[model samples]
Target: MGVIPFLLTYDIIIKFIEKSSIGINYLLIMSGGIILSLFLKGYLYFQGLNASHEAAFDTLMGMRIKFVEKMRKAPLGEINAKGVGSYKKNLIDDIDSVETLLAHMIPEGIPFVIVPILIYTMIFVTDWRLGLLSLGSIPFGFIPMMFMMKNGTKKMPMYYKSAEDMNNTIIEYINGMEVIKIFGRTTDSYKRYKDSVEGYRDFTLDWFRESWTYMAMYTAVLPCTILLLLPVELNVYLNGTLELSKFIFSLMLSMSAGVPLTRMLDFAPTVIQLTYKIDQLEKTFEGVQLKEGNESIAIKKHTIEFKNVTFAYEEEDVIKDVSFKLRQNTLTAIVGESGSGKSTLAKLLVHFWDIQKGEITLDGKNINKFSVTDLMNEISYVSQDNFLFNTSIMENIKIGNPKATEEEIKEAAKLAQCHDFIVEMEEGYNTIVGDSGDKLSGGQKQRITIARAILKNSPIIIMDEATAFTDPENEDKIQAALSKLIVGKTVLVIAHRLSTIVDADNIIVMDNGELIAQGTHKELLEKNHKYKTLWESHMKSMDWGIQVEEEEYA
Candidate 1:
């Protein structure tokens, strides 16, 4: 950026000397030197831009990726309220708009600014009258440009908003395509897509119309400078108001000044657009917040604790003043009906939302203090909605422990009761699960998810609705595997299959987001109406009405 202008200046100086006849060889020699230097500078600039472009792309991409990674470890309620589509739009599409500003407007535009300053300086010494004429004409061209900016400014926000809507529409359309297809609502997506595109198109046309309207007045009709300069030059030539050479030089230099001023005018819209784009990026980047220690790479020892916690969402009190201790090495089952905050309770334990009136600690330290990654590492979570990547069964299992050996992966699969079924498939563990594990049934997906958690080997295990949908046959096998997994671990289970955790060391019962009862299954049944009813329900569901069996809840 700094080199190109000086080369141009040197070339101009050679031409000036040739006009002055400062040794004819001087023109040839200096001109050749300037040409060669310009070629070298051009080559170097192109090469530098190539390398810079590569670096810029990587840096920008990493910035976006890291931004997302940061947000993933934040409060789920906040992230959801903001909408994933909007976040993606900000992270990718909005950021893409800044690329031109950074790569072109910043680096290349520096020289444009400097070259004008050099022109003004040279013209000032050569002829103050022409310099004044040059300077005066530059500002006159801006009258039309100022009006152009005023109109374009009004439409800038509309254009950007239209782009954002397009991004949001694409996300929603893709995500809901199946529903759209099932309901035969295909035109919804097309309409949304078309509307967003049309908005951008209309706004862009308006912007161009404003520019060209002003452009026609400024360029086609000749700027005030030409009308103004013509009189000054003719008066000087006819009346001998100045030296012929000086008058001649002034005319040529005045014309040269037009190109830069015109260029500066051409760049006016870019400057405006780039400014707005940068502001948009800054707004998004600043609005997103992060928890402390979230950037640390080390995992710390911590225990999950809920202390007099009260959590609510908008107007719904999902957890009301509930207090419990999740022991360091005990299996704790939290059994409750739907809307009893079973899954919500699990979310609390993982610090997905901060309790409104209570504190959650890990190893006696606040969960907020630990870096997000560190906190996640302390607990292996199996959400009610179990998800798997579209990859090999082995790869999905290995996600929990990236460096785990094949043997270790197989061991986790066996423990989760997934190994046998996986091996039955032709490709075995190598079989692709398809998108979100669609190739597998719900039960198969659940088992693989369990395998993933088992492989994580976190000190704390949270299994929310862990065994709810498994068939009786697979349920038994999964229960057997889970029995081994929960032993000597701080385990929190949210289960609807009440029989599976009948002997849990502790059972917590929640109703309307409040802890109604908590105790051993036998103790709870003896003391609480809710527990007794739930126990009776479980017994009837098993169809063991008259069968003799060991009564753990007796």
Candidate 2:
């Protein structure tokens, strides 16, 4: 399309110079050729762009799915350590940035690069001297581009780090808004959020400031092919060494080459930024993952055993040489101070992370031998931090067993002591839970999660402070439901309220990272000093609460 115009112009100039009358048929043919070339160019460009966008969207979906699968396989501790903001950036922002590379650069940039070379080839064939002169401004343009790329590469890490920091700060600020307001720390928290945003803004501006001069220089110089070609080509034509027609053709071809060359250079910054984004994604895709197996073996019993298991999040061991057996159809309770690794034990049982030493087995088979899905299918874990998706109450409960009927869901909710309250709501079972079940109270959310667990009816149930938020009146109801739920199942309960687990078949007492004692609650109270002390303290706190109530009544 570009060459056709230059060829037609050469023909017209020659005809005019010769003082010959141009025929109507010749003019019509040239006009038709120009129109045909333009239509073809536009049609091809549209098709290429359409194909590229489809490919780009497909690639985006595949990448996001792969990322989610990787997250599922990776250790939960590692995922949490990366923070919600980092994952948000990687999953949404960073991955979305690849669209430009796939949808624009690959399809359009290739043609832009190729067409310029072809245009230059035509000019060189016309007159080699003129072609050489046409490339004179290229070296100057390239000098600035090289500097820009080098500077961008050097600053890319810092820029990405600031962006991640800002994302994290913003998310943290929003999530902690309740705590901030409650504690009257809103001003301080806002300052930190403000500082993070300002830091990102300042760093971005500084980076742009450093590159703007080079950007201006290259963008101005790269397309000005006439800078050298016009003067030198004219002199050569005057000297009669170059034909007038060839001189004009060469000049037109050189000018045409500039459009494609400039278009190619326009993606240079995106290419650099894309490299950094891909590297960030690769770090996660290539990170260490929990080992899993493909076997699906039948278990005669749901007995879980941890044999001298030692594990660490980073360096310091959190669970040290801990060995315990949870027999089938028994309620086992783990009791400890805040950092005594009680919650960690429950997490390990579900294979949230592989232990560094020893083995965790289900019915004498190592847990790792079962596929992740199979392993998860056998256990129902309910933690103090109950998380529900932003969906209808029915859907949230249905997650435990997607095949469950509406009647089964309501039954489970009744067993969880949540049915009455749920049905009282305007939307009944279909009530939207809002974000993370924020529309419900802490106790209500906990009951909903319990309902989910009950609906699952897995062979093994692990409840870590599951009843921590329930009021005294509802606590008894939930305990009764829990008794029914745990019947004929393996249960592990982590309790801060010592009275709740007094009837547990076996109670494991932990201090620091080691299992200090394990026995029935009665045996532990008599034989273990730690257990006796914890019980005494719990009793004293209960009495203190009663005494305060009595005084208020007086």
Candidate 3:
């Protein structure tokens, strides 16, 4: 279908002397060729574009969802290693690079490679002289750019890292702009951001300049190919080495070879960068992802056991050979100074970090087998650094249970001691929180997070200093509400404030990542160790004149 029309048009057009005095037979064949070629090429072009678009869209969306799911399921140790700035860079800039490759660069380059081989092959059969010259031009056009493209690929990772640094600097500057102004420290740090922007600009423009300069030379090189073949073509014509029709076909073929060849060089940097970006995204996606299914966490029973569990972050052990157990429905408190691994212990029970050499079990089954999605369905966590999305107050509370009824949300808010203040707002439940709930005070934000947990009403509750920022009245109210919330669930409390968990059924004291003491509040005081010192400090900080007397062991 293609060959007959190409030859017919080539011969017919070459023979037609004047556009004014059109050859009827030649005109019909030429019109048919134009129509047929246009339709075929247009169809192929649209098909290729659509395929690339679909593929790029899937990879882009998949990377986003995969990274989010990985973060939710990965060990906190692994997840935290990838900081906010790096992850942000991957999501925004890195993904954009991949999209360019998938969409424009790759799809377009396919034609660059395919059409050249084909057009050159046809010219070779007609006249070998023009064919050899055309083949030689391919290497000349591509070889010089090969080293630069290789270097560009090597530079890509650092370029992305540098770009991310600029991104982070800008984000940091904006986030700290108010503080910088208040402290009058803007000049020093903001200048650094200005420099980073310039650096990125210079790097980018240099890359473009190098690519375009070489590319223009490569394109300009193609016309010289015609001149190189000129002598050979003339000799062939004079000695009956090439016929008039063959000469015409060779001319068209040489002209056609130039385009896809120059394009391959012009597109080289994009292709290289795209390949690199996709590889990076794949690395990001290769981590674990949380899944929802029947086989989630182990079934809850009347008791929970921690059998000599040990855990580490990188090389440093955060929790060491820790062993403890709690009867069902009891509040187990882990109390320690900051950095003593209290929070790490809380995370272990929730299966955030699987034990290295020990076992955590409910009903004598290892918890690691269960999916995080399943475990989260039964566990509610309120950390000291509570995070809330920018949304209506009602919706933030509803995060605990997306389908929670309005009444249920309000009741949860009431239980968390936030209902009164929420009602005072002009929009009440409809009030919109700014990013990370920044519009609210620490106490209010904590209460909102608490309300979210309450709305969840999971069977296992983990409170990691949940009241660290609540005011006195709100603290008392939240404590009272938490008392009710913990009634039937297994509760784990991680606190730096000893008083908060003074009434806990069990208090395990940690120091230097080791469990140094364990017992009820009364028992730990007589032990006269870290727990006693912590308790005494808590009492003194309150300015209490005397310690409350307890029943004597004597």
Candidate 4:
């Protein structure tokens, strides 16, 4: 296709120079060749582009799936430490950037690069001197591009860091919008968001500013193959050393090489960006992961034991040498002040993080011996976050048990005390929960998550401040429902409100990460100073409202 146009031009020039009649058949044949080349070029390009896109999409899907699988195997603490924004950028933006490399660079760029090389070869065959001149401009063109690439490489780290930082800040700003508004910190939050955005913009502009000069030089010089070729070729023709036909053919071919060469050069930055994106993805893929075993042993009991378990998010252990036993079908409560490792202990049992030392076992088998799926199937965890998907309330509940019937879902929702309010909503079970259940109140979302857990009906249940958001009236109702739901189940409750877990079969009092006392609530209150003090605090807090009302009336 590229050679045909140049051939046609050269033939016409020769016919004119010869001062002879141009044969109609010769013209027809050349014109037909030109048209056929164009049709084939378009057809092949379309087919190649479609194939590349299909391949790119498949690769993208596979990459994302693998990334998700890696994250699933990774420790929850590691994932949380990186922040949602970082993963979002890696998963969506960074991975998506590869499409340009796979789809455009591989399919279109190869042809562009090959066509230029082929044209240069043809020119070399015609006249070695013209080919040599055509090659002269390439070195000069590449010098600036080399400088541009060097500048891009030097600045790539800063550019990517800023992009990731901006993503993190934007996500934080959006997610914390409610808190910002409630606390009247809108200006501060907005300033941080604006600063991150500006930081990214500044780094991007600085990089482009540094590269643009080199870019202009290359963009101007690369396509001007005639810059050297035309002058030298014209001189040769004028000196009668080169025939007009050969001269015309070489010059036109040199000119035709420009487009493909320029197109090929355009992918240079994309290649660099692709390398950086892959590096970022590899960081996640190589992150620390929770180990799992291939064992599928059936457990006769749901008893969980954490024996001399030590763990940490970083250097210092948050759960230091913690040992406890949770017998099957018993309700155990973990209570402590903030950062006392109450929730951490429960999370350890859930295998959110692997223990640094000792063992966590189910039915006397090491928890690590059980596959993640097998371990998760035996326990239902309702975290403090009460995270719900942006879907129908019914669908969110059904996530606990995908095959759950509608009646079972409704029954679970009723048990969680969410059924009445769900029915009152316009769409009832079909209502979209909105992003992270923003459509529902804090308590409503909590109830929905509890409903999910209830539907799961796993032998083991971990409730980390599950009812923290429920009002006093609803708390009692939810507690009653929970009491029924926990029958013959190993239930572990982490609570701030002492009154809620008063009836727990065993209460584990923690102070600073150590389990200081473990007994029935009454026995712990009687024997442990920490438990007595915690009970005192709870009693005082519970009386504050009544005291305030009496003082107001007086």
Candidate 5:
């Protein structure tokens, strides 16, 4: 509609000058048509824009939901391997980048395309010779655009990779800032952060440099549809092959034709980017997803058995031919040196990653036979990480059992030995934890997580260094709480501190991903040289101290 007035406005001015008898009525009708065309053009464009935005927002919401679901269904090991930073980019940044393409390309680009076709047809119909002259610059203009697209395609993956690396590095730097400050290693850490920033900057500049020359050429040449027509049409008029009015009409149509083509070409890069983002998102879902039964199974008992389980994160096995069983209503402790696969064993039991060879069973049923939700419902896990969300203390605990009552939450917190401190705070249970529970001390966070597990009251509990952050004064209280929680429940404890697990019913010692010893703590200390060595080292580390007061007196 706008295109009609645009082309007519040119024709009307030329016609009025050629025929002065075209009176005030004709001029009034022309003005009214122009006004109507502008009104219709604005109205229709906005209507399409409103529809496009609604569709785009719906699509965005669905896409984000699907991505989150995929992440949940993905194997935990794979998620950890990809790192959190890349997922953040994919889920938030990459998904957001598609909005503009969806919102503008369909509504706006279509009109830009249709209007150009109509304008070009009008030019050709008016005078075929002038129409051909108007399009003479197209092939030349496309040359630079093609080169630009080619360069962009070749360099885009590398550019995204650099960006992903920078995101990962910056996330790590921010997360580890406290540790860096504590160790007085700010310079070295800041050097890594600076390097990532500078590297991203350099990659962006280099990517831009690759296409800038072509971009310049295309921008200068692509919109000049009438550049060739003007000179050639003038020559034709001089030769008496073209009329003045016809030449002017053709020129007007040609100018309008170039504008839409320019707009269309501008959208080309956005199309490429949209495709790339979709491809990247698809790649994120390509890895092994956690397979589970559609039907949820009833867990008859809390017994867990590993039947010659062999597993590996990569090539080398993290757990080789490992076999163990936790009987119902038993407390089992797994003790080992650092990097001895103790953590891996606990994670494997939870089906964090499927074993390379062998089977793990829960209640005499293959673990894989149970739905993910059903399996999660049967076990409570508190890892050393102790990650907490930015929410109220009560809400954080309630996450263990979403339907749990307020009294149940407070009871769990009291059992975990953090209720007193929580009550002492200004907001009590309503106090909002900062990001990852940064507002709380390490001991406080660990206790809160433990309280969550206690609140859940699952039949099986796996605690991977759950007491790591507890100070000496609070260790006994935590142990007392854990004692009550583990009663009548199968429990697996992975601990570095020998004293904490000495009273466990059965002790399993692993070395180099293989279970080397299994016995009572007393039996291991008497018969197992490896466990004895670890126990001795632990005792010395615990007992080591200086006689500072005596030295000062001397």
Candidate 6:
């Protein structure tokens, strides 16, 4: 309607110039209506965008919450296998991409597409021939889009894979920067990081170079609805089959149709990105299906029995036909050479990965029959890689028992031999540990984790080389802490240092994933050949140290 009045205003001006029209009322009214329409259009567009953003953010919040919940329920082994970089990307970057789909594509693209169809229909109703001519170029436009889709389909998977690889490399580079610097491996460390970045760059460039031709073709053809229609309309008017006013209106309407079509075409890449991201999110959700127990069993005792347990990580068995029993209120130490499955045994008892052949029983009941929550509550696990959060020292220790009082936290810290260091700090327990406890020394961090375990005070405590990083001076303190924490509790300790577990109630020797012998340290030293050799080696290594002498300098 506005187009007709505006076009007619042009004709009316010509008539007034010829002295065939005297008043300018029609021109003034048409100008006012166009101005009013422009204001209304701006208002509606902003309103729509605002509403879409609100919906998009709400949807994003829900998705993030569900994703976190899914991760919590998933097995730790499954999560580790997927890698932290992949998980972070899906949780943060992939979910952010969905916001683009909901906020812009669904709300704005709909109007951009639907309004054009309606506008073209109006043009066609006014003159059927012009309408047909206007849409004649769309088939050619689709030819380019089809090629783009084909090329995009082939490259998108590779694109996302390269991106994930780069993300992983970046995380590793940052986290291991200190190690790289200390080992003088700056070149090698940066090489891997550089390779991943270059790989992603090359992939992106190759994809764009291959698809640019098809993209240009579509861009050129999709928004030119008047290209073929204009000449045909002019020919019809010359033949006296169409009036000038109808011809002008048809031309304007064709241009309007092209505007929306062009806007709709711009959304094609967003659609592809959204579809691929959705697939990635679904894959993440499907990756970890944790096998949960039906009920939480009542555990009366802390004895653990592994009955002919056979287990594998990647088709190769790490623990083969392993049978062992740990009695309640006893300390059992597992000592073995490297790659001898010492840590694996401790992990199995904690149900980190289920065994392939037999069940592990706790208090004569299959551990699998107990709920994961109950199982975790019954055991306290401390490993060599003791992770500490970036928070106050007091808060980090309190994570073991969230309901623990401040006094209890201090007591646990004191028992772990970390109270002296904690109090020496400027803020004492309130000092932030920085990222992953980087602000603290290795021994300090280890002691804090021990404090956490002490605070947990579970009936069963499994220690996998928990004191491996501590200096000889702090070893005594840590041992004292362990003695207090494990009183009357079933303890399974994986030890690399033979001297630390020499007095263990029962020392189990492992070789090649098989338990070779089980006895006290003295009995093993006399009866087991492997145990004697390992002990000799450990003693020699402990005694070996560098000495600086003035005689040598002279």
Global lDDT scores for all candidate models? 0.76, 0.91, 0.79, 0.89, 0.89, 0.85
Q: Which stretches of candidate 3 lie over 4 Å from their true place?
A: 1-9, 17-22, 39-44, 105-107, 205-212, 223-225, 287-294, 544-554
Model 2 gets an lDDT of 0.91
Candidate closest to the true structure, highest lDDT = 2
| lDDT by residue for model 6 (71-132), tens | 86676777887788898899999999998888997667998877778867887898999888
Q: Candidate 1 local accuracy as lDDT?
A: 0.76
lDDT of 5 by residue, 196-256 (tens): 8899899899878877888788778889987789998999999998988888888877777
All candidates: TM-score = 0.84, 0.96, 0.89, 0.95, 0.93, 0.89
Residue pairs that clash (backbone atoms under 3 angstroms), model 4: none
Give the candidate number with the greatest TM-score.
2
Model 3 lDDT tens row, 4-103: 3456567666766333466687678687886887787678778878999999989889877866766677677676676667788778777766777778
Worst 10 residues of 6 by lDDT: 1-10
Candidate 5, which segments miss by more than 4 Å at Cα? 17-20, 242-246, 539-542, 549-554
Per-residue lDDT over 1-554 for candidate 1, one digit per residue giving the tens place of the 0 to 100 score: 33344444545665575675566687576666767777876886687677667767877897788677667765677677767666777787666766665565444565556666776676678767766765665554667778888988898888777766777777778788888899998887679778877877887787787788788766643234444556776686688766555555555545544555555566678878878876866665565453445454443443467888888866677788888888777888987778988888888777777667888877777777776667777889998798989899999999999999999999999998889999999999999999989899998898888999999998899999877668888888888888888777889988887887888889999988889889998899899999888878888887865767877884
- The model with the greater lDDT, 4 or 6, is 4
Instruction: Name the weakest run of 10 consecutive residues (lDDT summed) in model 1.
Output: 1-10
- The backbone clash count of each candidate, in order, is 3, 0, 1, 0, 0, 0
Model 6 residue 280 lDDT score: 91
Question: What's the CA error at residue 152 for candidate 6, in Å?
Answer: 1.5
Better of 4 and 6 by TM-score: 4
Native-referenced Cα lDDT, model 5: 0.89
Indicate the residue-level lDDT of 288 in model 1: 44
Stretches off by above 4 angstroms in model 4 are 19-21, 546-554
